[model samples]
Target: MKSNLVCRNRETVRINEYIHMPKQLSPAQVEQFWNDGFLFPVDAFDGVQAKKYRNLLEEAERDHPGEIHAEHRNNAHYILKFLDEIAHHPVILDVMEDLLGPDVLLTGTVLFIKEPQTPAFVSWHQDSTYTGIEPKEGITVWVALSEASSESGCMQMIPESHHQGILEHHDRFGENNILTRGQTIEGIEKERAVDVTLKPGQISLHHVRTVHSSTPNRSDDRRIGLALQSFIAASVKQTLGEDYALSVRGQDPFQHFLRARRPQSDYEPEGIAFREAANQRLSDILYHGSELKRDY
Candidate 1:
């Protein structure tokens, strides 16, 4: 558990071998996240590994055709081993712990895949608008399974928007919008937004309150990304009723949300059923009191 580092530019600063120091987020990067609301292109996985991960999604689609639809894309980690592994990945978790502190919970995971020349788009809206998690202490790590270029509809966000707190959003449910309600924030200056472009295996971490959206894919290939939602376990409250959460690190003493069991195999019957039930619970929290059937 102990390691030593040798500095080339100066005398080596010997960090205590027993002390745990996180190298994921530099102080500047942490500040940038708080001030700008997001960070992009963090190296999380190698290209070869990323391709393998992407293959898992393709394989799932082949095995369970028509099941990865937007409404049903939530909680994929519960039924897929590849996704579950990424959900608990150390690199992602360490950065999350750096920002959210210990006691991290992998709350949800979903695929946002846009086929080539499709009308799919994500409306500009803050994730908190639907998450309903109180204290608002969480982040969404969008991991690119393929190149997330501007032409491929990479996510775009307004800087420092998180500091404004949750903004008002209205349900549009547009034909091409992938959001549950087609929710969007009004009057955003397109010129002020920054594209969160990423190559395969990289990631963009955005705060829950960050105003973000994506355009329709215009490329010749599919644009695939995984949104991994995590939060400080102790910060989760009962405001949205009992829910399911996976403890990826540290201890969960409060048990604010129901603990999820890892799947024994990909899409195991029991795991799928459990994920379905849990997704329904989540939908209730996100779209509470609405007549719309629980989806997403």
Candidate 2:
């Protein structure tokens, strides 16, 4: 489970027999991964760092409120500007590079903030479906900025569900639920569900195709998390379809969006198109969200 991989030039790369310090995974952990398609307790951020990011998120929320888009809200793309000082400290880079290999590109980021008494709940589905990529090579690092537990609607997954590949998604209704648009899947059990609860700063890593979801926050405390999805260095490609805001350092904002194949045939093409358009529209609405921050 130990890796001799070494990072070079800010890009992660593998070196054989180099014995360079790298994150080590145990045989049992690897086997569990092979069976469950996910890993947990890899490394967690410190409280100070978590609080720093939490404050930043609060500020953003105060400024933008409901104006932020799905992609741009919570400063997802601009994390590096404050990541070192906030969360995802250098300690995480080792495990990330170990799992994703060198030459990594952060493809997606999300902040799951479950406020007290909110009925929001994420539907069961694989992460790869939303990512515009192929071959399903990516890692989702879910860092708990606050305490996460089943009572507060922690994440749950079906062990070894990734091996089943893409499963049909069904429409689910609730407070915050997945509108699967009336799709169904066969050969899967609803009885097998594992809730993943972590203390503040703890993290969980899962394969892109792993089936996962979370329930609403019914507890009094808010459950906040920052998720960063990283892929191998070779996964970068110019977006060919819709337009999205990208925050590459020292470059113009990324306005081009790419469209990749849907993981399930039941995925609604019209819904996808509407989501893309809505994202663009939201970006326009919050165009000044980042402009107000002179230091970000």
Candidate 3:
């Protein structure tokens, strides 16, 4: 499993030979991700560590009234350094690198939080549909900050649906659907879906074309999950618009994206401006040529 990767300025280096790569995801789990279109319960952080992140998010929500709402949550990693740290966490990078090779780029991250007995829920859809990344060269790592169970609205995926490629999706704009456009697919058998349950500090990885959604939270506690999108740097290109990606591991010789910088502080004026501009561009790409522009 040794290979040479090219970095910026046409430089080449051996990934495994020079770097201390951790074996996070076992071969069985990797195979499951490919075969079942998703793998869950990958231990990422401990319960104590998870609580620290949850506290930060709660503090942010309390500090800024509506700033953490649906429209602003899409790219929260770029706006806050703490979120960015989690996205670039060593454990997460190791798993992503194992699947996407050494050259990995973080495209975007969105925080989906469901309140107790709330109507908020995600509709069934594929991430590749609106992502605009061709050839389905991406994986989404969903990290749970709190316990995620069927009762708390954990994500559910249809096994082997990713092999069918991208399916037809129609925008319904459901009132309580958490998805940006309320996009959904038809003819899906709900009974075939598997709940991707995870304890606090665990995560689930799914392919870009996987058909997935979440139910409304029925428990009293809040359900917090961060959806991180990772792509191989070599596969990145200016498909819909300028691709804004942060290289988390190895090097990106392709230069296909606008390299994002680390934030100095959470919600700084300059960082907020940059995050807003980048998010606007992404929304235009994901919601382009469509009448329905649901806030992400």
Candidate 4:
């Protein structure tokens, strides 16, 4: 279908207050997201813009090679500062509203770089465990800047896994599921794993509680993705003095940021509240962990 959203020379689109999707999501797709807690192939960024962002990331890596983690040699650099330009992007806001409703807050931003030949594997787990958010209804939009496929270590998810509620998790490098409060859940069928492959610019939106993971890059091309997680304000509750903490750019270290959504029908309240809550929560949890300390 032709997009009414016009692009400026294929690199960027001029998004104003009137942003809307050329095609509204079908009722089935909406139900799928609600029931399964994930959505795939939602247009957030286009090819040209993805290329531009990729170049920016490459430059960041080149200038700051030291910033690249040793264990993640295949992994490079990332940043997540506020960008009014992105906030106004039509496709982004459109999908944000569709999934999160009108009241969506920006919780956290991450730029994941998997260099070629990197053997780092992200174990299966739920994202809400790390965010420390209550309700755990947040949405994480993963935007692929390059062609991501199973051969190149794309993401994998368990179908309808979120329906199982929070599962038991272990720390990637530690003994207990540092963020899971030492709790564990049984009954995950490993045979149901599904790999996600996508072309450059394609995006996937999943719930914070969804069981997901990614393999190391075995492909020659680098695998890069920008992850933006959003939530509704009402779903976020403060959790301070907890064993686990959520770290952000400028805030003191604290444990967990809850993901929440405004009542589904109240769009305006949801959007405004989410925006404010995310800013505070992200600023608090953005950079908790230090640089990578392993050799993949």
- lDDT for each residue of candidate 4 in 1-296, tens digit (9 for 90 to 100): 11221111011211312264323465566566656667777666688977886776576566655433332222111121222234335676566555554444555445566778877556677777645555566677777889888978888888777665567664345332222122233455767877778888788878777888777889999988766654433334544322211222122322244333322331245444554454444434422342422222
lDDT by residue (1-296, candidate 1, tens digit) is 00111121011111211144454877667667766889987999999999999888898888786556656798888888888898888899888876666778878888899999898999899987777787665789999999999999999999978766678898887878998888889998889999999999999999888899999999998999999975554557747778888888888888888888788898789998998888888888878756664356
| lDDT value, residue 85 of candidate 2 | 30
- CA RMSD per model (angstroms): 7.1, 11.0, 5.1, 12.4
Q: Which residue pairs show backbone clashes in model 2? A: 12-102, 12-103, 13-102, 103-233
Worst 10 residues of 2 by lDDT: 1-10
TM-score of 4: 0.65
Candidate 2 C-alpha RMSD relative to the actual structure: 11.0
TM-score of 3: 0.91
Candidate 1 Cα RMSD after full superposition onto the native fold (Å): 7.1
Query: How many clashes does each candidate structure show, in the order listed?
Result: 0, 4, 0, 25
The weakest ten consecutive residues by lDDT in model 4 span 5-14
Query: lDDT by residue for model 3 over 1-296, one digit each (tens)?
Result: 00111121112113432354336876667666666778888889999999999999999888985668656788888778889989988998888876667788888888889999998999999998887775565789999999899999999999988777678898888899888888999889999999999988998998887899999999999999999975554556657878688888988888788888678988888888888887888899889778978666
The reply for model 2, stretches above 4 Å from the true place, is 1-21, 24-31, 66-75, 83-88, 171-175, 178-188, 236-296
Q: What does the lDDT come to for candidate 3?
A: 0.81
Candidate order (TM-score): 3, 1, 2, 4
